[model samples]
Target: MHLRQFNKAGVEAFRRFLEACRENPKEPVPVDLLESHEHTVLTSKQIVVEPREFSSRRQAADYFQDLLSPIPPDAVRKDAGIWTWLSLFYFDQICPTGNGNRKVRNDYTYIYMPDESRYFYRHLLFIAWQVKQVAPECNRLFLDSSLVTLDKLTTEVFKRLYLTRIPCLFELLDRLYWDCSNNRPAKGIVSPHKISAGDLVHRFPTRIRQLEKTYDLQSLDADQLLEILGDEFRQRAATSQSQMELSMQ
Candidate 1:
């Protein structure tokens, strides 16, 4: 998905979007054209182009701050509504903002170009995951509808499963579904089923590293991969429990 420039026209459009949302909170936004950006943009530009050009860092920061200021107070009222709006309308606007601040280059960059993938801005996906905590039902709906949009915008592993031919991937989605249903904590080391989909996606690379020398996943079949993932999940659960126990000592 293309990053929305926090330019004059984009900012005004967002304001109107928020007004529309406040007026009809439950009614879904007309997102068909907006949502279709996934296939179109990813295919056209396989890289995150630097969308905003600033003459100086100060100008960019001021522009970003403008975008941040108009966040509707009522947007946060429905929990996931605000974040959904953010993900949909504003996430890309300030993605390349400075130091997580509006400034240009601070010591850190909040958003950057996608390296090997066609997506960028991972923190937004984490925010999407956070939506599950306060608004599970809302989060579910949002995830169901917007996951493709998110996948189009970021290099997310969960998105990879959407196109995966592996049968175990469906099992993984099933486990995540049940985890959300059960209201398990999304943070910390835990069973794969109990972890948030976004958290699991974030941690999977590391977990894969933990198993790299132990299993040649590339050589395994779908069922074998499923078993291996289960083994690792249980090991992580046990490790989490041990750490929790030690913390009490």
Candidate 2:
């Protein structure tokens, strides 16, 4: 009866309402919907999504430029600029933006410098979730300075809790890099090649290459994470629809 989001069940419920409107034509709106002002909440909140866009590597290099702000972009150091850049974009893309009907996706793109051969599409859900929790105000601060309003102090306190509990998951990323580097074994004894740890590129693939799909892999790759999320959303929608149909019957 909540009908919070418009899945198949919510749709069916809406159809029933419309049918009632046709059949009775004079009855007051359903209490479950008219009980509050939340009926149109989604419409007011939905951000319009634009067409997806791609970008070149040189452009990516500029956006990922090292931040000179109070917090360093490369928190783990060793100049993981690409990883840092990807994390932000990736977090923003992990889910469809809207809660109902066509959750808008972010239009984002980036590329590697010089080579420009590989283009990476990123979705940084964990990072976004962390920021949403720890420093949400900071997350939306946007460096404008003028936008820092004190209206969200309570939310900010929770944001602080989020970061403390998660630590932004940097250590976990470090271990992932270590694993990716060791997996190849450097084609046997990679020393004497003047390769530093910084030279190693940590490549997470588009799928769950080896690990089983579980909470254990909260930060493996964007695509797999999105897949898990998509499945969950689908299952929840199906359940809701089933419940709504059951109730009407």
Candidate 3:
């Protein structure tokens, strides 16, 4: 179907629908509300969006990036209506019905809150799309999980403004966490105590902050950053690389 954006009335209607869904999670989404032309207008840049299941957030991001390429970046970013509409379009994936119920979270998780900077990053689709646009290289580390999961690693990395903007930081994260053989993040990286003393969840960002104070991190690439990291990270990187080599043999 052609891409569309909700009008102000449409957004309000969507909000009301969400409230109802929260009250009765088993209630099916109204097809009429989703398809009503009066509630939504065609997008300025016409693009077809078919109903499809995405294996991972990475795939979904890539799909959206390609589909929305015709529209200006700023236009896409600022348009809350379009994103909210997309959320409704893929409601089943985001809030799957299982065992006669759907576990819907806070409204912000599905609806794009453009005016509220604090909640802006909470929208699942918007955040996935934004992260892919900003840090394409870290997709394996960040977006490899199923569309519904908002993993700790992704939350930790993206919440930090400095981390998101730096190309070197993305490279460092990829080297440290991404499992090349499996094409997924290294196991236990996200758990605070699961990996080791200094895990990605608890220590990586703090360590980077400390390093930033003492060094011009922007000037350093991933290799240099690796050398500067504590033994915990270096050892893990070494172990991962060794395993990768062994797997290839």
TM-score of each: 0.28, 0.18, 0.89
Candidates ranked by lDDT = 3, 1, 2
Tell how far residue 228 is off in model 1, in angstroms. 2.5
Tens digit of per-residue lDDT, candidate 3, span 83-109:
999999999988888898888888888
Worst-scoring 10-residue span by lDDT in model 3: 192-201
Clashing pairs in 1: none
Best by lDDT: 3
In angstroms, the error of model 1 at 242 is: 23
By the TM-score metric, which is better: model 2 or model 3? 3
Candidate 3 lDDT (Cα, 0 to 1): 0.81
Compute the lDDT for candidate 2.
0.29
Give the lDDT of residue 163 in candidate 3. Answer: 74
Model 1 per-residue lDDT tens digits across residues 1-249: 432223333334444554554455443433442334331222123222233544432333334334333433233222322223333444334333333333222111222222323322343433344233223331332243332133321233434523233334333433332234224323432344445433455455555555557876556553565456556555544444555456566
Misplaced by over 4 Å in model 2 are 1-5, 8-41, 53-165, 175-249
lDDT of 1 at 12: 41
Please report, in order, the local distance difference test score of every candidate based on alpha carbons.
0.37, 0.29, 0.81
